[model samples]
Target: MAVDPSDKKALNIAMRQKLFAVATSRDVAAFEELFRYYGPRVRAYMAKLSRDGQFAEELMQETMVAVWNKAAQYSPDKGNVSTWIFTIARNQRIDHWRKANRPDFDPNDPAFVPAEIKPADAAFDMNEDADRLHRAMETLPPEQLELLRLSFFEEASHGTISEKLGLPLGTVKSRIRLAFAKLRTALEDRS
Candidate 1:
């Protein structure tokens, strides 16, 4: 007797459910699948939010490690896997920001902290929607993300960016507003 493709799909779904269970129960193979599917995208998102390539890489690795440790708590019905994972990545980014403010550290002292290390395969997937959001940043005309990156990322005053970019204050404000609106629409269309 030959097996039907729909039967195969049913089996696959069952297998995925079982995998999710095993993943929740600390099985390494299941964990590896989750990492393979989501890791690069998470890294890309963190990379975009960081100060530079190295810091972003470190934060991305930290985010994935947290995902591994926290996988057991994931609730499939609560949300899709990507959103839940992105939440974890965002929280880690916030934590990195808070930690950046420590006072009076000596690199040679025993109390001094070591620099963060990035994952060996921290390179992002060339094309995940989440990853594209990072690259889609570049899709916006340079003047646009620049104004918006400064406005949101650096919290620079419009006046400040206007001075830096040599544009009229009104033009800077309009471009940032339009850039954000377009990005929102594009992401919504994808979702």
Candidate 2:
């Protein structure tokens, strides 16, 4: 059977949508289909990234497991299925690398670690600095403070904060910049 390219593309998208729905609903068949479709590709990608077939295979399995567990976190509006899957694969690879290279330490070895107590004066200075920063933050306008909170404390990108708050990107950036400048000046004066 000769299928047109457009038809193939449409079929792929349809299958992806169905797979997402099934995965979201915790269907074993859907997970099997997804694994069958993406497993080899993920393995190849991880192998290329890690340059080790055995580790890549392990990472691929872990990625698929993570996808199965986090399928419900997928949002079509954020990205497509391939991107979501690849992101998981990439994270699994990173995690595998971190685990493989982690250093083992013995808690009882005096030569393995050093504990230094902070001087009382240094602790008092740190507390004063924190209080000063808190007071400076309080001096910011409500809107600017909210932008700062979203950008720093919440660790959200400015674009995301803009979209979430229904504000323009430029406005969000400018507000955050202004807030930061105010904080810097206030903190420096106190110092």
Candidate 3:
């Protein structure tokens, strides 16, 4: 049966609601629909922002992986799916740029490795703890994740990330602070 276009908006709303519910429930088919729908758009967006075909394709995959992993937290009331998905793609591109441009550091430097951490116990499963941490990370807001990624992985100076992302430096700092606070709260009671 041919789908009518007259009620596209309503159809989109219903699809989003259903997809959001299914994704939250870990239904693979519903999540696949979202991936196929937005994957190309994300690739095109990253291509435009990066001006590199291969880089764009790579970042697109990264963004989609993040979306798959984080879909449960999506909220249609807070923002449309496109906006939320695009924001993730944009942040991934920014992160790629930052990593490509990070200053080279000497591997021989002793300070690069933490001294106090125990070497013998490093390989412990700690499966229960890790599962808890993953759940907490899943709960973080997109804005907070973006800020935290920029601050820690990109290591973009507050002024630079703010300028690059067109956000105020204070806002960037605030979001990173909040992201860390959330992580701390999530881990406070764990052993």
TM-scores, all candidates, are 0.42, 0.51, 0.49
Q: What is the alpha-carbon lDDT for the whole of candidate 1?
A: 0.72
- The TM-score obtained by model 1 is 0.42
lDDT of 1 by residue, 1-191 (tens): 12243575554444355447655676777656556656777777776776477877777688778877776677766765667778988998888777887666667885676766655555343346667587557678888877878988899999999898899999988998889888887777766
Candidate number achieving the greatest TM-score relative to the actual structure: 2
**lDDT (0 to 1) per candidate:** 0.72, 0.84, 0.78
Q: What is the C-alpha RMSD of each candidate to the true structure, in Å?
A: 29.0, 20.9, 27.3
- Per-residue lDDT tens digits for candidate 3, residues 1-191, read 12243666664675576467556677777667667777888888888877889988898899888887877777878877778888889888788779989988987678786577545456455656788787778889988887777877788889988998899988888888888888889888564
Please tell me which model should have the higher lDDT, number 1 or number 2. 2
Q: Mind sharing the TM-score for model 2?
A: 0.51
Indicate the residue-level lDDT of 39 in model 1: 72
